[model samples]
Target: MDHYSFFDRDLSWLLFNERILMEAEKETLPVLERVNFLSIFSSNLDEFYRVRIPVLLAVHKLAKRGSSEKEDVLLEAQALIGYQQQKFGKIFTGQLIPLLKQHKVNLLFNEPIPNNIADKVMDYFYSQVMSFLQPIDLADTKKSFFPENNRLYFFISLRTANDLERNVILAIPSNQLPRFYSVSVADEQYILFLDDIIRHNLNKLFKNEVVTGCYSFKITRDAELDLKDEYHGDLSEQIEKQLLKRDMGIATRFLHQPGIPLRTLHFITDKFGLQSSSVVEGGIYHNLKDLMSLPVNNPLLRYTRWAPINSYHVTDEGSLFDHIEKQDYIFHAPYQSYNTILRFFNEAATDASVDEISVTLYRVASDSRIVNALISAANNGKKVRVMVELKARFDEANNIKWAKKMKAAGVDIIYSDKALKVHAKIALVKRQVNGRDKYSGLLATGNFNESTAAFYTDHIMMTANPLLLREMELLFMFLAKGKKSAEGYPVDFKHLLVAQFNLQSRFMELIDQEIANAKQGLPAAITIKLNNLEERKLIGKLYEASQAGVKINMIVRSICCLIPGVKGMSEHINIRRIVDRYLEHGRIFVFENNGDQKVFMGSADWMNRNIYRRIEVCFPVYDEKIKAEVMQLISLQLQDNVQAVNLDTALQNIRIEPKPPLIQAQRGIYEFLKAKSDN
Candidate 1:
């Protein structure tokens, strides 16, 4: 672990965000999709300030302020962020606006409102926006003032009687109103931001005063919640309290309009406790994450939608249980349907012989059919148990809400222990078939939420294997009653790799097997696809395999610390990342053991938290057909050059020189599955 170099984790994440920005800058992509990329980039940067900046600030503050590694990181991040912001502005103002205008879609920014549309804009403003406006005096002596997180406000300069000037903060009505105001004028269409409409009506608000200048600004606050050590008190209660405290946490970044007067900026900064961090000068529009909601409804200007591919494995519309019982079935999401799993739960809920249901809910959709099916199962006199992980960040409130509803519906709700987050995705259905208890189980690399299944490429395994189901039953029991009710919960996992006990060791042993195979002059190769790869010891093991001449291909989507292609350390290691129509979210580890390959997929990423902190599960792919499907999917991804980028040691995305008959992996997989279905 010590001999080699590693990329800084936060910086690596910044590079990933930069790749998203690069997507926005790609001329080949559709303009509207590029705008969506811009929104994703903007939101990503906001989170960087919200979450990562706080940690960096804490490190910088406790050390020598002038010269620290954290300070250098902040400076570097600012530079990179500044560059990206400038690019975003150029793309927005210079390129996208003109292109949309060419298509007769007018998105007017900093342009004079033509005579035809001014009246409608004012009428809409008076009716809809005027009531939402709340202008506050910056010089109020009654109370102290500070900006809230991520909301847009205007720092305005106004002139009153006797030539006296006043500074005010105009809270833009974007919260209660749409960010864009679209209207058609005869043959021309106009779209305006809510900021400018208010800007146009500034004189109306200031009756006796002269409107001077108006500029936009927003604040990004530190959003990382601190959970106390487990032995303190009730974990859920503590989490609720911490969520409230998050609003009052330290402000990390102050983003302001570029042309604001020095006096106004100073007045605003001094009134609030925003003197510590550097202020970033930005455009009149602050939260451009709203760009995701661009109101153009033309299909010609957007990416063509593709219908989700069907599961060829489930050939007929027979019982899902029958299909899985015939052989193990693996479902690839987005490219394949999620309804089969939904049917599994619905059938379990409605089937007359079904007796019990168990599931782990990490993050469910707001209108989750899964939870509804579970509630129905409980109402039908079936034993239903749900392990809701309330510590899922940004999702705690929703999970808590669902948990209360499920608890009220006569379902058994077991909250996750504060010491370990149950991040594994698994569901068990116990049924009495012919008076003998039979088990059907589901395991996946993603959440059970159907919303993300439309865009996140994840793997789900439907298995009727008795051994795996028995182990899963033990896991549920252990989760419900930790350490006390189970005899060998932590020590003895052979088929499934659980995080607290066997995940890291099993992966290490697998890597060692590959290394031994290579040393013995046999075929040794590995392909791993994961969201992140940062655990130092496992990375070190990969490095060892590299030195032993075992070829490794890693498709890491984000925050990869391993420096691949380094001589004498990781020469045999190569890493590429695919950022495309679908998020590469599934975790797969394929090892070539001389000729017979071994495939395993699961929820656990090769990160410290996933390995040592959370309760995760990685299960082996035993069925030959399902194993081949998983391998085929991985092989398609490896052949992909249209969306794949080779991640070099400098962390730059060097485009892979695509082979002939260029393969876009997601499309190829869809076609492959479709052909299989046809056959």
Candidate 2:
């Protein structure tokens, strides 16, 4: 076998973020949409600092006695981020702001407030923002203050009555108030940052002191929860306690606006014990993810909305279960309405025949109609079992809230072992049809979240396949035991590929089959779409198949470690990345078994966390029509030139130039599904 190289995961993630920046740079897109891409880029970077940078820093420290490989990767990551930040600044200031101005909307980006709107800005601040402001005098050691993670604050330099210098920290109330304040003067609209609003009114709070300088800053902390593997206590309570400390975790990045005095910076760093943090000089405004709330609603300055097409028709007389039992159905989300899936749960909740309901809730929506329906099912005398994953990062609180509500409503709630997270998006319902147990199931590529379903492109399959649903019920049964490992589980899972048991091995076997056929002088190919691609073993297997003359194509939205188009290793592999109005989130796998092709779609990405640590379900497309639909969707994504970019050997996103009849996969999928619906 040939030796292969992989891109550093952190650097590869940065490359993905850069693709987002590229979308922000497109002049043809609506200015606000471009601003949204910038917001997404900023938000993604903050997550990297909170999650990945700490891991990198720890690895760098551990490598003190080893090679400098870890240190080099860390430095390269920093350099790449710095370059991207500079590019972000140029795009925001040089391109987007001007475009907004052309549309009679003025966005104040690091600029002083105009004199015309001074009265309106201060009036709004005095009435709405003053109550949320909390200032701590850093000079007074008796008063204790800890800067919360990712919350914006400002360092103030002041001269008091005694002519002595004092330092104070004031928390920006962006959490309490809108980040951008909008006011209309005549026919033009002007948007002001809440940062500027507070900056303009500092003297009012400090009546006896002279404000010298003020700069904004925020701290990014490690987001990992410290869940013990063998804890006998309530996991929900344990996670809730950990979540309170999440904002106070050890700081990983101390991002501050430039031009702070050196002594002030050091004093603040020492006071907060941020000595080991990555101190970075950022823009005048911190947390530009707030740009998503620009407070301007101009339909003409945004992408014309595509109404979600009703793909699955559920009549008043017929329940969703009636359609599923007759034939298999698939719905592409955002392009197709999520109401069909919602109605699946809604019907199960009310149907007198439904005897039991089971599901895995990883990330539940805050106002989850699905959870409400589950609660309703429990009240309707149906057996409800929910494996609520309390370990879903950043969503621990919301999931816990819904779990408690469901438990209160007499629903049987199951929690996964601390070490294993059930990332599967699946639901099972058992009904008594003709006094016999019949089942209908839903397996999807994304969360069962109605909120995310509106903006995230995902695929959901509603089926009555007995073999598949029986295996799903067995998996749920295994989860009920709260076992840390799947080693002793009796389920074989021949039809469904589940992580921790058969998902990885089955995928490897599929790749091996492709390699075998390629070596036999037969046409062999593989296509996969995932949010991330990082497991080295699977990547190596893909390389081995490529060496055997199997063609591999992948659409990885972010974090690809496998270096494609490499000589003697992965010469036949091609990777595409698509970023557009909707997040490309569905995970699809296709393999050519000589002449017969097999397709699987589910929640599992090839990331190590998904394969080795979590319980994920990827089910086969057994129906010929649904199989053709899945194949056609992947084909469109592979042919996309407008919103898709190819990953080169160096892992850079290379734009696919416009050929004749250029295709944007998301739009094309919508149109394709629309025509089908019309027919």
Candidate 3:
């Protein structure tokens, strides 16, 4: 183990983001799509600051005086990020902006407002933007203003009549107003940043003073909610209280535009108590995630929309339950219609036979139709029990809001303990048929949120498998107890690999089986796809299997700590990462038992939190047809040369160069599903 090495998780994550930035550099993609990739990269970096940077800061602080490893990692992360930010700016200005100009669209990136649109910009600023502006005099110590996390602000330096200097902070109300303003002048489109609009209008606000400098900046704070295991209050209420305080957490990154005087920068830093933060000098504009909302709506500048195919078409006469009861079905999201999933809940809500409904809601949509269906089921006199994870990061408020609504509608709401979260995306529907209980269920690899389903590539299986549903039912019953641990409930989960009980052990056993087979001179292999792979124990097992001559291929979308393709350790293992139009989010695990293959898919990533803390369900694929389809999809992704890149041991995303007939997995999956639907 001492000889073996693993990539640092944060550095690996930065490499994943670099993959996204690489997408923006592709000359073949649509310009708007490239802009979108840029937006995603920026947004992902903001989240890293809000989440991971705080941990790194804590690690750096706690390291002993003689130890430099922690500090070195922190500095390396900062340097890599600085390099990526420079590359981001170049791609935006050098490539994307010029491409937009060729299409007769001018996106004003760090440029002055042209004379043609000056009047309109002024009029719009005066009428709309001025109302949201709140300027704080930084000189006034009594006022004490705290900047919210990730909210844009302008640090204004002013000189008065007596040459007395005054510094002020003006909040850019991007939350209250649009981040960009678009105006058309004589058949040409011009897009303006709201920051620039307010910059141009600084004189209108400060009449008697000379505005010396205005630089845009934002503070990204740690987003971890403080939850005590022994907390006695209602978990949802406690989470709501913490959500308000989340933005006020310790600042991790202080990003400001360059050219601020050193004296003023120190003064501002001390003033905001950002002494411990990593101060990054950035471009003129902050929060370029607003580039996603650029007012250019040309169809040619975007990826041609592929309408979701109807995978499981339920005839109007027959219900979704009827189809599931006959045979199991799988739906690939964004490529396959999510309506069948909706109809599963919709029919369960109204069906006369359904007597009870159970589900686990992690991160729900704001206006979730599935929650509405659960509320309807409760109102329709069915027993509805929902385990809503109040600890879903950044989505605590929305989940709490829906939980209260469902509880008000007489639905039984169960909240997981503060120490654990229910991350399983599963739903169970029980019906009374001929004096016996019949169960139909949905187990998915992603959240049951329709909004994300439109763009996140995931897999959902609708099944009437009694064994799996029975195990799921037992798990829900255990969840109803709301205990902090899964120890006392002694139900053996044979069909479903549930975290905190059998998930890690069962996966170890599966890998061990492959290792044994490989040792016996039999054919053995493993394939897995996940959003992240960071758990060390399982990674060690994979390494052991690789040493045993078991072939392993993995597609990890982000944060892979396992150093693949190493000599004498993981020489047989290869990892690929795919980043494209849709977010690749489904988790699939396959192991070859000599000639027979076993497949499993669910919400669990091989991360520390998923293995030891969260309640996750990874169920085996029992149906041969569905298993074949899942294998085929994984095969397509493995064959992808266009969007897939091999994640080298050095943490670089090495592009798999195009062969003769290049295959992009997302596009190929859509076409395959479309052809399947056509047949």
Candidate 4:
């Protein structure tokens, strides 16, 4: 409870994953959706180890300045992950299994196939699965062979012709084949894991050698790309070179099935040269993250679908730009269709009055309609410029491909700055309104990727404001010139809060104003909705605001370091984390300016990278109706009892105090918007 102390970001992230696990543990939800949550949890941990574990290990090997703090954090993260995996096991076996049986979708794990479907499964093994699998003998191979990262493998204990025990590894081709095999036998239906199918047919895999036992295991390698801090060459080329060597990075986690003979374990470790800490004991079947493709088409066993509804702007006739000029509109995504945002680009591409289009692409969908529109606009002879960030971790290749395509289409492709990443989501379309050039653009709290926009909560503002649009034009010019020309780039802005220059200072000033108001006995409050909050200065400022009696509420989806509700230190602050059907991704900052409230939404979180290393934007909600809409949305999220967990002093995601009426914020937003559209 000491003042100025913060939670470790990695550990806080584990608590967030734990919240996702809790969703899988819920008995009320349909078994399929619960399975989806389980898949999400497992996948989240997989990426965590892939991306973060190497960074910690690098402090010793790469940085050569290894600290005990990093070591301690790795240990803590691993221990928590181990504990959660145990819980996951129990949920899958104890809860999920029985529920599956109740629904007649028997998802068999490592257990043997039933007598009725045994023949059918054997037929599938020979016809489909057997052709793809080829086991490699670990003891017989001369050199150490590396397995593909995160792939499911069967570690077999075989008795050779000499009556000696030999261990071999056979990969489960879940990548090429489906993980779950559905077998329909007469009146009942069954789902079997590919692990079990391989396990039952081990004799067929090794015809000459006698198979004794089969167990599942997987390995996770360090997936961090260590691009040189100072790269004078092409960023895309360096990243591509590193990406090819990703599988060869340090082995972070070596997870094997529990109770594998010590001799086999030792042979496996010695072959791979794995450290003691790298080895982790897992359950029967590895890589349950494949549960996402359960392949069941039953609607009754899934959450009732709530389709995204179109708002008034999309349905309104005439140009999309004209509507924005008349009034600033916000697209509350998934609750409202992302099609409107897509329509903006489509209309801009075809509009004869529009002559120039510019935007920043951080992470776009694989099949992006927005990109298609930009291509169309460029082909139509309009000046289209795109500043594409090629450093969007795991998405570098896709962005590069799009960049090449856009460049070939006569569009100006802008690479990122050498030292900084462009993370802002903004698009500008300049059109001649009565021979006077005006701008219609969008400022969003998330990526322009329509695929993620379906579920990731974000605020996209469509406006034709002269001041904001002019600044956006200047920003595109600044980005187009690359890093060296940023001197006279007009970094100082009065309307849009730009990161690396004004965002942090402006936020601190706002917090200071709240503190002053609180000291003057005026109504002072601040509400923040973001994905992460790990910035030290901002967290310290929040501590100051809490001491000054400004009430604060936060809805952080992941990685919250600031502990709340502590006596005398953070008594006036409370934080809520909501994990529901849709991701809580919008970053809304609401400050009570006495009786008048000011709202801002943006891409930047209160994190170090977002505040300093990247270019971000936070725009104000000026329209009264839009402001009220955001206020109500945040209020609904704050009031959510279901799917909302209170981040306790010990960093535990404890259940909120339940009341009679329940409020799930994602559902609330959808219903609120749908009701408005109906009216």
Candidate 5:
């Protein structure tokens, strides 16, 4: 058991998805809420096939440079996903469907529609949905219809009146129509997928032909759009062109009904050039993730919504930066109001004394107040520089749109170089107070998108620390001026760990200190909560510390490759994942550091892209109270028996080494924090 070796990355990611499925299976959750989790699982797996599995398969086929482990990684990933998909199916149709019925919310398939409801459904379809419905005959035209990315399609099997057997694929007009068609029938409100509405009306679609049963199916194509540098004249133009061609990216998974006739399957597969036997056989309907949009007005059917609570400063006192100058304030979002951060931007935009504002946009919301603030600042004669990453996955188009808008408003917009993405969430504001130039900055663990700010548990730190502020100014200079020399920026950061120089080394130094302390038989330990932990070097360092008897606890929300609890190998390492109310985002790294307990929180995870390839900032928790708060969160997550899954030596996702009474950590933490504020 070499310290450098660990579990395969893809297999570990599958284990993380299994943890999400486990949350959906928790009986304590309300029925419809469980349904939401199932939809999320289905959606997540669809992405896994489209993005991840294809990459692994491609590497295995090409045996790209130095990927000797590619074939084995792919095989292990296939096995793990196959097993998890089986479990996902059981949870969805077996548990979720029956449970929905228990709440009088029935998701029916081919169940005879009552006359009154069928009439209403027909009327609704004719008025609203019929205009958009365009059913293509697959038999007449051997021409294949490619389903749009993540869109639903129905395969219609028909026997002609002349005894000519044929199969036709109908594109369910779900993109134009509402996914859920609600009808009031027999005093029950039934929600039907739009696919069902088309299924009920097959006769109307195939005017002259006799109709047979319609089986619902969908195909998830490789969504990764490759903008080849040699082929693409312009990066933005190539990306835009590929966005249209993304539907045609090599087909990864042909998800279909289990009972599709052999002939139909062969014809479809051959037409689509699908040579693999990895066709996923699902139940009648595919893409039930659309059920997430189902209209169920019952408040009890969803998780109890909590409006973002205010921090001690904003709720008790009005001014944000005023308190920031006195002491650095840490804000945890989705729990703490993100509006406060918005207020910071809003104030900066309107302040007459503020001279400049700079921010990096990785992913901005469609209607972003942050963008609007930048525009307002530029309009007010302030130097507003925005570095928007145009290569953000699936978000390139939105970012391009906003970049143009911001540029039109006089913002000095800087798009990233094609090779690297600027993922750092940073905002620097320069103001003049009493004829002295003062600097304030906001460092965030998530995007500037307000939409996700409600569902993603992230942290934003507001500080007036001249040391950090000056270093941030240097970072912006590096982005704008492209200075290679260390002296071009304020390089001395005693508090912050900025990538490109000290982040990786500082992390190793912290881990080595823990290992040395453990070797000395001191109280040495480390705890990390991050979104991803796939970088081999970081994992190896942790393993080294673990082997040296340093206790390690990690609560990684996704893509963990390290195998924990292996005897004499990783015996002191433990890993758990929490999938609950809000997304377990926000990267927090804690080091025992010879029992002084150094803690840092930031936007960057331990992934290769985050640590080296992007400009990220991991800031220290100078405020002891906030450090304790974050530490408490890691402690609760590690202790969580419910809504948390533990990874074993074999990389099996076992639900937290079960104890008598389980602690559902996320809920417990919420209660714990809310109670603290109340006290």
Candidate 6:
């Protein structure tokens, strides 16, 4: 193994979070959009602490006392995130709210509200929100109050008629009520958080007690769901049991008032065995992410909706299968319509010839039309086999619900077997054409979510090649049966690089070939576009290639740990991150194999989990025209200066200094596709 010094993964992830914060800090972005950026930053951090940080903590505790690197990494991550969290608070409270006020939108609290508005709020709370309040007196009760994930609570302190301090805990019923309620007075419209609604009604909630003050806060727990070895019982049932305990996860971070009387804090912490260090003194309000749901009775506060552009390859007159039969068609999602992939399934369902449909669903939308079409296929007497992964992060419940729905629809459902989670996005359809068995399949980089398809850039390869589609069917067969002893067909994968089989080796070989070409004074280059790049071995290989004079250009949207542009180390490597209107999610790899370029796009990223652990597929672009189009898209992204930010050696995100006449890549690509359609 090559001696490598890589940035810690957790710290690198924190840097990604900071980059998101940087977007919030940008004055160029719209004021409301900036607030949305802060909301995104907080939500992303909540998930990071819930899933990733807890795993690291578990690994550290299991290892006992070997390397200090893990602990060090955790400490550094906490410090960096803490700094960024402070910055986020400052930006939101100091900058964004003031800007919103300038736009005539004021988010007010209980700081001497104007008498008329205060009376109106009190009347509103009494008639509309008072009945929803449930208060527990903490002074006399031995029963504890445990808040669920992302739930808001208020600690109310009161002075009784006997001149004694008493406390009551109230749960904010925002789940049942809107987070923001608009109240209009004379000529001004004011927005108030539901927290304030409860705040305004404190005296009503504690009718007998005289309310002194009430503070609003929340706690985010470590959300890593643990599971045991599978037994003879049903797996779905077992998962359901485990999921019920999801709320009981260890508390990771607690956001509370700055000084709520140390005794009161201690009482609450003692009940939960939480330490003060884990407790963050957040502002008066908790769960600021509720800002994302800002009721837009005013359409001017929201972003203008943009329709997803349709791909040039898809036309109203033809079956998607017929088009794929001619040549491999690549669907670039959000940019190119996801309807192409949907039409593929819809057509397969309606076609009398299609005999079987197999798909692997990871994170699907709640109202998934994809699942609806799959059900329609099963109803049409087609063999619909769905390998629904219930282990998708934060989406386990949704996946489980869909799994039961699909199972009830008479579709064959397969859950994951062992330690592996099937993260692949593949759909195989077996059809009979001219009384002969023909196959079609789709391999995508992102999940089959229709709503997200309008905002997330993804690539899906639709093909009718028997050589590839037959293997996909077999692969799903093996996945469904859980037959580990069964070997895959001994056929050469000329186009697709399936993980757990050939993806890693193929990537290494491609990198080595580039290195060799560079040494031989030939044209050698590589371009990689991925959501994350954190695998140490792959980064080392890229560094080796870079040292050998191979130019590498990388567009990694998140969690990039490699240090680029270092003298004598990775001088030839260029790293850029694009945060634009659409999420840059498609994973594409282009290698200059002695100038005979090879381009591939699929679900796999450079993360080790994607390559060596999970089931992923990266398929080569066979059609020259499509390959050219993909190359043009990649080239446009490579040259993007408007939304692109360069990553420095220390991972500090430096804004890309744009040229005079700048190009925003997504808009440019839309124009490019439109021009192609016109031609």
TM-score of each: 0.96, 0.98, 0.98, 0.96, 0.93, 0.95
lDDT of 6 at 437: 80
Query: Per-residue lDDT tens digits of candidate 4, residues 82-138?
Result: 999999999989998888788777888767789999999999999999998977877
Q: If both were scored by lDDT, which would come out higher, candidate 3 or candidate 5?
A: 3
Candidate 2 — worst ten consecutive residues by lDDT sum?
64-73
lDDT of each: 0.86, 0.92, 0.92, 0.86, 0.79, 0.80
Q: Which residue pairs of candidate 3 clash? A: none
- Candidate 3 per-residue lDDT, tens place, 473-537, comes to 99998999987898867889989999999999999999999999999999999999999999989
* Backbone-clash count (model 1): 0
lDDT of 4 at 183: 79
Alpha-carbon lDDT of model 5 = 0.79
lDDT (Cα, 0-100) at 483 in candidate 6: 44
Root-mean-square deviation (CA) per prediction: 2.1, 1.3, 1.2, 2.2, 2.8, 2.3
What's the C-alpha lDDT at position 318 in model 2?
Answer: 76
- Model 4 has an lDDT value of 0.86
lDDT (Cα, 0-100) at 627 in candidate 6: 88
* Candidate 6 weakest ten by summed lDDT: 483-492
Query: How well is each residue in 317-427 modelled by candidate 1, as lDDT tens digits?
Result: 766777777788888898888888888899999988789999999989989999999999999999999999989978987888888899999999987666678899999
For model 5, give the 10-residue run with minimal summed lDDT: 482-491
